[model samples]
Target: MEYMDMYKKWLEFDEDTRKELEGLDEKEIMERFYKELEFGTGGLRGIIGAGTNRMNVYTVRKATQGLANYIKKQGIENPSVAIAYDSRLYSDRFAKEAALILNANGIKTYMYKELRPTPMLSFAVRNLKSTAGIVITASHNPKQYNGYKVYWSDGGQVTEEHAEGILKEITSIDYSDIKTMEFDKAVDLGLFNYIDDEVEKDYVELVKGLTVNWDVVERVKDTLKVIYTPLHGTGNKPVRRVLEEIGYKNVYVVKEQENPDPNFSTVKYPNPEEHEVFTRAIEMAKELEADLIIGTDPDCDRVGVVVKNKEGEYVVLTGNQTGALLTHYILENLKATGKMPENGVVIKTIVTTEMARKIAESFDVEIMDVLTGFKYIGEKIKEFEEKKDRKFIFGFEESYGYLAGDFVRDKDGVIASMLICEMAGFYKLKGMSLYEGLMSLYEKYGYFVEDLKSVTLEGIEGSQRIKEIMEMLRMEPPRDIAGIKVKEVKDYLKGIGDLPKSNVVQIILEDESIITARPSGTEPKIKFYFAVKGKDNAEAKDKVKRIKDEFLKHVKL
Candidate 1:
């Protein structure tokens, strides 16, 4: 079995791996070797280390070999892959290892020399017309973590079918069976190529083209003071360039967190979704009297925002709020410029706030819902482009990921950052802050409050607990919660609504609130999503409280 085989490999490992194996206790050893680091639908993601269950050069090579084989099986001539890396520890090394494996298989490689964002890698896939692409970064995962994401020729994350096929090849192949070559020799053979600054240049131009209100941005550039932080990731250069190119003159960067650091020394977590990630940026904003602050995660696919409310205090805006704000800005500007399409479509994750639907309806643009994950949004964008049915005006999720225009298939924080700055300036010219804009939307569309929480359960016992939770919900559906009747329960595993099968459930309450529960595929956790609407903020808060309390009580986890 692979378990003992990997244990034997550990025994025969080189100096570093042998040391790592010796350091672990029996339980740790089993945990590390009981299973290979799964090449899941999202590719290989785990703690970066020596074990088979961790993301190391060996594991990365194995995944890449599988990807290369898949490309070869497609019978595409001169197959090539584009690779990029973030600033996480060993990310660059892992990326190079992947390229080496792909090169060993006669697949050409186009790689960025320095760290870049996930979205940039997506752009590279389309720009180079590569057969597939790879990015080595954990996104917002903690310092102990690192990841390798694979994208197809479609410029989107590999879909379910491709991932599963590649995973089969990865899982069946022996660890030593993965092919690799010396980096220098690969380069000499022209199998490994470096993507030049031209990619970054074109990427910036592409994102700038997504801007909705350039004239308004220029008008308010000088008067509007803003703070931006990349949180030590790939967003620094591109984000700043787009803002500067669009006439954001008074933009200020948080000096302390400007450069990339693998440990994310300034904050415990590098995720923009967390308010603490904006600590230094917030301090700088207050000192500079900036009206708004924006931050992006390490890989730069997600953006978080902070705005000065009417009370003059800086408050973090939820992903839902930011999505709604961007949706409003883009639609309003399009209509103002007479660029609104009669059948433009906006896309959001099914779990994202319904407020987006209401906003799209107000603008007469059709809004469609997809399963969670930005790849679905990208899938729709590709579909629209192919069918020529409806134009994709915007795509977003509740986790701060957003995309506009068809340039890049993935959610792009670089573009989101530029547009948010421009949107803030548009309102500042009218003597209102971003908070005011959000409040106005709430007033117009009722208060649609949303919340998300993850309950982590680790290892073998923990997985059973997660399974129990899902089974419990399916076997005994709740008919009422806090006196709110349940209207329907949609088990996504049964393949509901034309979406691919997944382990998710959407519970629609009688009052139209939604509660979704699903086990996270990428982490050892189960995520719960809540979206509640009410007449006012207070009422929304109360309903959220009651629903969450009663719902959790029913689950009894």
Candidate 2:
């Protein structure tokens, strides 16, 4: 009945929404209005459509109203917000709607003049000293989806406590109570302002400054052939500019994917994690005889890489692989240049490869393992600032997200791409490819491989099934997986030692092999992560497969 009410309310919308909903079947109507689009810790994300469960102007305004109310309660005199959007459909419109709604609620808004990557929004929040920030992007989700991610003045995703407060405020307000002003009126009233390119220049300069050895890059600038693709998102301009200005003359952009396209015409999805997203870039690399390829997701928060093996075939690197390689390079360079600190630390998620730990230890740098999300890593960065106990060297997760500096609290592809190019250049100077660099890391550390498998469960019933699966695993926990004895079980929900409580479980084997299961916070899926190390590459991969196959038997997929 509630869904039916929302369906009726949404039908009173504009002509396009009304016409779109007029012909929906009963199932379609229920699917679109069964419940409000979830505003989780990640903020609002959903398929763009006409109902309460979809991402539309009404929902965006409602969320903004809630955020405004929360800000007012914080007692910040004349609070402000920074806003940015990506190339997704309706992203710009949603961003403008949010800004105006904030303006109507008596808050100043600093919005980007055009589409930009998510990390820039993070930087803008701190640079502009705004009360909060919002970026309209779904990250790497399909084209049907768009999102609104909120960040505090710290330039990181809103804290869990903040998420709860905003949610309470959101629930108290009715959809009809949402306020907004015209864009022109907001601009005239001095409540709305556009951020200029100077901020971009500042951001690019900071990224370029992260280069470890520009001397090597300059030497290999003309010889190192690099291919890059933005995946039709927001990374094209900034990434290209940073590389070019930093002295890479042989960089080639994938022409077909260089510009914004909401449809993501050439790939199944804009996710760099999927090999399919690199088809165009790989072709360009092979034709150009490039040494390396890089691709970033839609919002450019996460990045992926491809490198030529000794056999001259392009091999895609997993997020863990890239993170490991970058870790080794950064630490090695720091020590060589005598910039290594006594208290430097490397942070990674619990599900990431243990190779990061091994690599950090080899360099005598401490490795800190946080919870799965990058926000926890960001929280640690904030903690480091207040305590000044440890200096952050690098942070990454298993999902292609990485960060080297604390200038931006979130994962940054712009900086990651720049460092990756520098790393490749450093290797080229030694007559080795990035693949051979990875091989050397494995040679020193044991061979480690990781795999991630996701089982998507959609709709109301599917959500229930997901809950059931999780409960079963917790109640009857696996004693052993694939003949390896279970050494210990870490149930993150019960609140691990110092980490926040989360709905995730990990079974550690006697051999130190690890398996983690958790429901995705941003999508309707439960992801399983397997990490194992063995004497060689084939053994490591085979152990992962065996462990994954055996673990799936315990849960109903």
Candidate 3:
């Protein structure tokens, strides 16, 4: 159907809803109804509006109905699904609506009493032995955006096969025929059950088990001054509780952002990747003379960190840099304690820095590179568990998501926050700042600096433009980037790379620098990842600036 037809349907809503739809202009309606929300590797994410493509009650109902249909066809006896939501706008209502729809379909539902992180939802699905799960969250998207992510029985986001099946069911559903029961009626029917505290306790205990050396944590617990901020999302209570339980006494939470605010009142973007999100936290750290500052994105799936350099200036570390630091720290500590597993593997995305691979190699650990999604990492962890071939050590992506263990099959900012603080304490005990440790790591390894640029393509036309640009790049590949000769081109779409098939392209320069171009799955954008190695810190910094400048010149962004 045309967008105008969708717009007319939206206008036919009841009084209040019709008024709301009428308030929006033609552009708003067109943008909302232009295309259906896609189920990519990241699941469904979109702006909140009154259209089939938007994330509203009707869309949620349809998605839930389809999920229920898929579960029924699977022939699982007494199939149940777990549901959870974040602190975003209408997340609670959406969660309840999803549960009610599933319950009305004769499927059991286990939902959290309140908002929770995405990882907790993943854990709950496996703990409750449910056939599937739904988390009403957009991870770290801005305030205007929301999403719904589905998970399989193994507690990982639904993979391609499962997603395709769910999409088929979704396509077969008639929007008007999808049934939804009242929340109270669903509760009375005994099909709805609220998850209890025992699950939280179990999750906390599982996270505690990820620790390699509690003694190190206890040694400098009081001495290490650390600042943490959840960026006004679902991570506040759990992260703080974990830190306190693990014996970190000097942890300080940013007061301004301690509570959940759907608008994310303090920052323009709730994402931790942007340094501006850490402005207030950095100021607080400066006042307290703290050694480390940590920030987690809204859903608590991604974490960012800043540390004081030797020059007493705070430097926000890239996701790859932070991941390398944490990975090296964990593996080295394990090796020192004689606990390094011979058959251990580290997982990362193809766009992530190769420096992590180099670090893992020094410890004789294997590295597995996957497409740009944590679900792939989770899938690998599940594989390792089943095959008993290798232990999953650490998993991270270039977008500030990290996981230390298999406790939860997702990028967990709660655990990442705890581990990052503990690592800071480890360096504090050695009479060095985290930044100094980073420098030392660079000195031992080579100086590796990585950067990323995202180009947003809005509206329907923007997507077509993105496709045209990718085709142009593929057909007429750049021979050189910034006066540097292109040594190799790895096109993941054709599966011609060090890894499998994906819609990504990597260019290797003569200087050993690397550049990757890939489209974002959740949002309409194109991302460029650049990595350059230098002999020393000065050389690395200069090369990063030069490479970034040259990259912009070539891409003209």
lDDT (CA) per prediction: 0.89, 0.91, 0.86
Q: Kindly indicate the candidate among 2 and 3 with the higher TM-score.
A: 2
Task: Sort the predicted structures by lDDT, highest score first.
Answer: 2, 1, 3
Stretches of candidate 2 above 4 Å error? none
**Tens-digit lDDT track of model 3 for 1-557:** 79889778867766655777886888888887777787755668888867877888888888889888989999999999999888888899989999999999999899998888899898999999989999999878889999999998899999888888998888787777698787788888889999988998899888877887788987988778889998988888888888888878888989999898889999998998888989999999999999899998888889999998878888888898889989999999999988888799999997888889899999999998998889989999999999998999999998999998786899999889888988988888899988888888888889888878889998778898778777766777778876778898888889864544777888889998988889888888998888888888788778767777886676656
Error of 1 at 192 (Å): 0.6
Pitting candidate 1 against candidate 3, the one with the higher lDDT is 1
TM-score of 2: 0.99
Higher-ranked by lDDT: 1 or 2:
2
- Model 3 scores a C-alpha lDDT of 0.86
Give RMSD to native, each candidate.
1.1, 1.0, 1.6
Residues 301-384, model 2: lDDT tens digits: 999999989888888899999999999999999999988877999999999999999999998899999998888899999999
Clashes of each: 0, 0, 0
